[model samples]
Target chain A: MSPSDSLAATGEDQLVSLLTQNLPQSARTLHGPGDDCAVLQNHDSSSLTLFKTDCLVAGIHFTMDTDPARVGAKALNRTISDIAAMGGQPSEALVTLALPPDLPLSWPLGLYKGLRNAARRSHTGIAGGETSSLPKGAPPVISIALLGSVAPPHLVLRSTGQPSHIIAVTGRLGGSLAGHHLDFKPRLAEAQWLAAHGPPSAMMDLSDGLAKDLPRLAAASRTGWHLLPDSIRRHRRCSIHQALSDGEDYELLATFPPDLWPDLSAAWRLQFPKVPLTAIGTLTNPDIKSPPLSGGWDHFS
Target chain B: MSPSDSLAATGEDQLVSLLTQNLPQSARTLHGPGDDCAVLQNHDSSSLTLFKTDCLVAGIHFTMDTDPARVGAKALNRTISDIAAMGGQPSEALVTLALPPDLPLSWPLGLYKGLRNAARRSHTGIAGGETSSLPKGAPPVISIALLGSVAPPHLVLRSTGQPSHIIAVTGRLGGSLAGHHLDFKPRLAEAQWLAAHGPPSAMMDLSDGLAKDLPRLAAASRTGWHLLPDSIRRHRRCSIHQALSDGEDYELLATFPPDLWPDLSAAWRLQFPKVPLTAIGTLTNPDIKSPPLSGGWDHFS
Candidate 1:
């Protein structure tokens, strides 16, 4: 294979799309791939099962010297964030770790402590996990697969946004690597509150920033977006560009009907007074061109 | 931490024990942490859900030059084998990949082809997955998490074996690394047949060779094993030691009541004539001393 055909050149988004296209789907699969979580038909007609998997690799997600507890927390929280994006309640999780043999026992012990604490806080049970040896010089890799459930009527999906829907985000974006990536709580409660009251037309977590993720949501819903640049909320001291491009901001990016925005915003203010819900844009017709966006995190970049 | 306190010094077994101790469990958890798969209560009281996660790391499970297709098959098959051990039917899977950016995109495409073929044959759906980049020079890692289900009456567990139960294994054992490790079919059909006919007292897949895994089955059931060395059925031309320690056999090892052996063997021969079912040992009282057996795969050793 030539250098141009390498994964680096193909990029994460294109590679994932190429690999997952026309993959297997069963009668039980409510929705597969492309969404934040895969939705599966459950025995109970009233709810559906949500399945997702994610990984955190050292040198990419964290350094060897980083606090092991936070590393563990981040690993589980990332997957939980996917569940939260679907307006689901996390039920159980299985973890897998590939570690270099020379790592101290204390590292994994601290990691498990964090994992246990995080699972407890989310009401998710840590069902089981396995550990294996990595190559001599390789860094540790932590992977988690989580199972969650959502009531059929409340399950939100990225492919349901409509033209003219008001686009909004929960909390500030950008500058997540300055410790927020490791510490930000998933918007599980806030999402559940929205689902219980009245779910938005579409919803997803902004892990890869608005520049990349918003486009994905738009593509999935067969719509375009018109961003209000001045309304895009930024983290403390972050610029508008950074707010649009910097990834790892685990905030909810959702769309609501224009008619429901007034009541939804008022109710959200009363429910989660501490977290900011900022309306930043509106969905547009698919033919309407969106402003070019760049600089969001890309793994193979 | 001292060198003696490293994970290599503690061994994989001890390390897993240290990390998984007292993990949180919920009302829906039927079994957690020790079985081949974690069993969770499903909506239908007649059946339960089985969840498991396993990973194949580069340099550990396979080398860079190894066929990407085989690597992909092995990754999914390994986790599917876990569900089969519990007499369950594979349902859906989520795959996560960590790859070095410079690797050719063709590698992942081939891997996905293999994954799709395996899922098709196993009647499993590919729900969804995530991909991330590994550091430069790092090899690729593929991790799979599978969800399966088993009828309540047919559920099998390693912890339920009894003294005097006849221990039998499906097919030959050991020397798997020669070629079988990559191509051996998981005994899903055979296990489900057994469950439908007469469930085993206890069962598990032999991934870490009989010497290690049999002891685990015994330990879990509070029993001991008495092996009939002459009766062990080894792969063609494999020595007794290799048959006992090569690991990655991916065959079912099960314990049955002595009284049911004749009828069960007769029925199994008619059901799966090509597959050999050999009775190799019997469970002994936990306090009884048996011949010391050693040599099995251990990750950190």
Candidate 2:
């Protein structure tokens, strides 16, 4: 079979793997391709540049009836969340919009309003963008590339977890489809606090749900996970399975040393009183197989 | 009429005006929107960051018969050309691809290979990207966001031209549709040499043809331009009208002090013996009534 046929047979995961496996790494590239953000050395040696890009398609991410402003807000928020995941400060963004030729002016205007509002809240500037007309019947597509920076000492990555680390998450999970995904604030401040205090060994935003994302962290760290289902916090009316696989939670999942759990929990409560920070699992030896959980989401699936 | 209807009534230019009219500008922003790239302050304090984004839709940028690698290379080259226009060195790029649901894996792989190859030649790294499946029947779209840096003193802007300055362009223009658009290199080296020597008072790439883009530089500089039609360079067998209106030439358009023209031309010939660098016009007083030229490509026209 041709590469195309084999790719179609295998799916999106394989496609992503094939696309990224052999990219040339530059001298300044500290982390490339596999992380939430590509980390690069800034001309200023004090900080590292964080680069990330994400896309939101109208049909897949939201319906036409969804508020245009929320659509805009979610577009920027998704990339902002990635920066937050890296314990970085989002500084600028470039937005690219592809719309059907007949899209109403108000719709795009409202979207920009939402984007501007969210960007202001996050202290990020929308520096530039490109707007184009797609084919007559295509849906609107929004893609944002966000740039950020973090002090090297405060930076976090999913690959740094250890076998004995306790897994903790901030905020409830699941039912993001009920509007939480569009409105949740990126945990930028919380991440900075964690990096300064608890100093997570590993960290990432809960974009694809606990079940799907936990495995990524585990795989990155070359470990496995042992989740205590009862300890997992869920939104009211959501099941453990739903909490584990609904995705788009926009919460923070992190690993802390077992001994630091008490001090970390205390500090988190004091720092973010309304947000719940719960310990739900522990990193384990890779050889220990845990119960299988449903995957959160796959764009091509 | 609804906002959409009114927007359709007013057209793309009006829509662009509405979208950019009141955008919040940050303190670090040196130039925002309205240019080939947005300029921002680098933390290093010695240089400025150049940010630009451009998108290529299948039907708009290329056809199915177009090589997939060329499609990929063109996507990156578009933004690299923007950086070159600003006299900067491209350092990183983030690519976002939206492919048809059943696109052969070979297609996207070929596209990435082209993108990687071009990025390598330009000294840019493919740092990160997002991939998604377009709705059934929708065409492929590729968007790229490029980042670069330039010494503060070497920076160029389209709005900095002065009356009496000579207008010059590097390389031939027009007939890009015949395949030059897909294969042409962004004038990165020529731009750097010009910035270091002639130090253009104003600069921008000729993406939307000379007739259309010259007026942009004129409007931004608050001046008018008097192009000597006989002096304009054209691709082999291309007419003067085609040379003036055919977009996607990807050549550098710049202004230099009339006193420096002889030296600039001599140095340019020595530096790029194969690429033609021709002076075709002079910036004029804004009140001058130069012959009107037709506008170039508009996304929603």
Candidate 3:
């Protein structure tokens, strides 16, 4: 097959693998790709540095008509959320912006203001980044790279959960398209609490919906999961399927030992009264066969 | 005046300032924007982490016809150069790519291969990043974020040079558009050597040409510079003016104490026989006035 044909047939996952194939790993790298963030061992050894990058294209993440400040804020939040998913505290961020040459200066100014506000809220200092003009007809793109820190003991990974662990989610999911995607706060505090207390065995942010992301966590942990359809939480306007399949929820999906669920659930409610922590399923044995689950948003698909 | 109109008149630098204005600085941020990289104090006070991001747009950095591998390599190299300029060792990188949905997968595969090759050459690992599809007509964009480390003493800054220091540049300059820009090495080894030896008082990469970048180094150091037109080393095909005004040279511009030039120059030659270190100017007192120098490439202008 032609190179393009072969690449096209394999899709995004295969393409990423092809791109990263055989790349050397630094001795400092503790956890590389296939997770919410790459964790690198710091010279101190007591703390690990978390690195994550998330990009937002105008048409895909927001439209030209979307408030520029919100767009900027979302860009910062997306990466910050990833750090949160890793059960870490964000420390700094670098932003890269690509804009049309003729774009009015106010748009970028407003966008920066939004980014500054979000960074302040998250206590993530905007460090250094680059800005360049795009081709005339191209859409503006904002990409943020975040650096965070996690105490080695408190660090969580999607690959560490064991079968029979109770699967739980923080906050409600689904209906993010109704504007929650733009304004929802990342559950940084909640993740921190989970890491410190029940200390989730595996954790990730639900940017790609439960149906798709759950499978990822399962695959990474070398296990399987079964969602209790009746236990799925949804927005008033959302169906159970939408709760499972719609993305951009920015909530945390975590697994805890079944023995800790009772106390952990109580503590979560006491700590974050406004956000609900619900038990939705259990991680299954790797050998178990389950019916196929609906896939979530895939940029390539 | 309307915000847009005000921003338009102020331009990119002003926009960057306005964007960063009133942003809180974390206690961990030892250095922020306005430099090659942001230096964050690691939890272990002995080592500092360096952060930087640079973006490349299709039409602005290269044309669609440019080799895909070169595009990927350039993206990785650009950020690596920033780390090099800071006299640091790059450890990890995250790459964000935005491409048109219909783009041939082979193009991305080629781009990844190029990125992987460059990362290997620098011994910098490609950690994790995000990829998303752009609007149909939008051009592809690549942005890279690099994490590196520098010993406190070996760390260099563009704002630390003193008046009367000798200004020198590594390698040739100008006419990079002829194809040198895409393929030039990042001078990482040379920078590491300088930091370990005479150690530049201030340093930066010549991505925007001497005329423009020299002023930046001087301004950051709170000084002025006088370049001897005859002393500049340029590409054979480049004119004196082009040598000063053209950008993307990716060479190192460094300032050293006048007393150390003889020893530093001799050592540089002995260490890098193929790369010429040329003394072209001297940093002047901040109050000194010189004729207006030509500005380098400005994204907004």
TM-score of each: 0.98, 0.97, 0.97
Per-residue lDDT tens digits for candidate 3, residues B49-105, read 899999998888998898899988998998899899999999899989888766777
Docking class of 3: medium
lDDT of 3 by residue, A1-301 (tens): 2466633355566666666667667888888888999999876878888999999998888888888998888888888889999889999888888887678777887888888899889888888788887767678899899999999989999999899999999888888888888888888888988889989999999998888888889989999987786787788889988888889999999999999899989888889898989998899998662545767777765
lDDT of 1 by residue, B1-301 (tens): 3434888898887888788889998679999999999999987788899999999998888877888888888899999999999999999999999999988988999889889989999999999999989999886778899999999989999999999999999999878878899887899999999877868999999999998888889989999989887788999999888888999999999999999999999999999999999998899999753656777888876
Give Cα distance to truth, residue B53, candidate 2, Å.
1.4
TM-score of 3: 0.97
- Better by lDDT, candidate 3 or 1: 1
DockQ rank order = 1, 3, 2
Candidate 2 vs candidate 3, DockQ winner: 3
Q: Which tens-of-lDDT digit does each residue in A1-301 have in candidate 1?
A: 3334989899889898898988988789989999999999977798899999999999998888888899889999999999999999999999999988888888899888889989999999999987888988887889999999999989999999999999999999989889998888899999888777768899999988899899999999999998887898789999988898888899999999999999999999998998988899899998774676677889997
Question: What's the DockQ for every one of the candidates?
Answer: 0.70, 0.63, 0.65
Q: Is the docking of candidate 2 incorrect, acceptable, medium or high quality?
A: medium
**Native-interface RMSD of candidate 2:** 1.9
For residue A51, model 3's alpha carbon misses the true position, in angstroms, by 0.7
By DockQ, the best candidate is 1
TM-score of structure candidate 2: 0.97
